[model samples]
Target: METIKISVIIPSYKPQNYLWECLESIQVQTMPQEEFEVILILNGCREPYSKAIESFISKHPAGNLTMLQTDIPGVSNARNMGIDNARGEFLTFIDDDDYISPTYLQELYNIAKDGITPVSNVIAFNHVTGQYETNYLTECYKHLYNKDKITIMQARSFMSVPVAKILSTNAIGIRRFDPEFKVGEDGLFMFQISNRIKILKAASPSCVYYRRNRDGSAINSLRPRGQRLKNNFKLMTNYTKYYLQDIRHYNIFFYISRLVAEMISMTFAVRGKIQQ
Candidate 1:
């Protein structure tokens, strides 16, 4: 058997409408089939969707795909399952609703092999409007190369989101997702690993992240203001400790201020929704 260099981890819920396209994109990746494996973690999906995913996997070339079923109810749990089950030297988290360009995996693989610890590329589309949004660290990242030494602040800022990045699961070690944090688990996971991992940013916009806008979709619905505030407070607390431990005091206050502002805005957002 050929060795697998990359493991694509996809956490899926009842995303029947989008899973086929997402799987198809992976099957057609420009990276040769022998180079990578796709692991689909199906959390709380009904039998019908499971059967569909199975059927798709059966038709694919051997040794390229595997599907695991988990009773876990949240995305965080599903992602953690992926992390635990991943067998590739490099692991990637791709959302079930998103589809990548054919060159996405190959591009990420090329940069990752350059000895960068955690490498991430640009997410080109929001999947709602088919447009890209500027990330918080895009400008700062422009100054850093694939092999440059990165401060904890730079790593934290760059790794704010787990998606759009390909990481060496073996280098920094696989950090499981926090199942308790449904809102900012990805951010928290990235924050925890940023300190121990070197950073690399890919210059391509090949990853297409699709944000579903339908009502009740995880990305669409808003939680209570109190809940949002609580989550933000926890994230800030965690981020502060992570930064302070790494001696990046400059970014600590920035995180606090951003948390406060987001909390305030969330309050008004909740009120507006209630009024509507």
Candidate 2:
């Protein structure tokens, strides 16, 4: 009868061999099991993976893992289901392929206890290329090294991928993911949260957010420029609904710019596909 402090929502769909490692990382958190729970959503998975996961759960009954199955096709739908079933004070997202560090939960829990969205510096481990990426998100996050807490309004350019972050349940309330856009849905979800809540800095590098550069097996590897453009249009459509609601919303300017950029991208994508 322990009150759950953080609910680690892992929405997995046709995951890689690294999924077991991802679940294992959560199992070994320094934080007590009573203080946290892992909600592993089996998103539209078929036999072998589903059977393997069932067996995996049975062997490690001490982790307080809750398995929820859904025939829903998208990660957003899976995550929305997680939010509905979450019995925690806060929510943290973990991709099935990404294995976190031992202190990942403890560090995030410490910050989440304060009612702020905790964002940490992540190690983007590309197991395929054997390279660790240092993108613009990492570069901008470095600027927060001197501070402990930050207002999301001030740090608008901060990465909103829903990774390396923990958010309060009340802050997220009933806001479900827009399942239309396959790509950038996480970022869009984070942006909506940012508009609604105060974001804090937990920039200390903790988790190794593993990204495998595999072939068509990966969700990211399946899309082409045309597909990306179509998804971006869908993303902007959802974003525009939020944008028009309040023209004065803190990140409205960024939203408009993003919408315009998506338009340009769609144009290019259409022309490119036509030439093909």
Whose TM-score is greatest here? 2
For residue 226, model 1's alpha carbon misses the true position, in angstroms, by 1.6
Quote each prediction's TM-score: 0.78, 0.85
The ten-residue window of minimal lDDT in model 1 covers 206-215
> What's the CA error at residue 146 for candidate 2, in Å?
2.5
The reply for model 2, stretches above 4 Å from the true place, is 1-3, 153-159, 215-219, 222-227, 246-249, 260-264, 267-276
With a 3 Å backbone cut-off (N, CA, C), the pairs that clash in candidate 1 are none
Clashes of 1: 0
- Which candidate gets the maximum lDDT versus the true structure? 2
* Candidate 1 TM-score, true structure as reference: 0.78
Tens-digit lDDT track of model 2 for 1-276 = 345888899998887688998998889888888888899898887777788988998999885898888887888999999999888888888888777778877887776676666666655556677687765556656776557667764455454577677778887877788897666777677667656665576545653344444445444444477677768778887777776765565476567656775677677666664211
Candidate 2: what lDDT? 0.73
Native-to-model Cα distance after best TM-score fit, residue 13 in candidate 1, in Å: 0.5
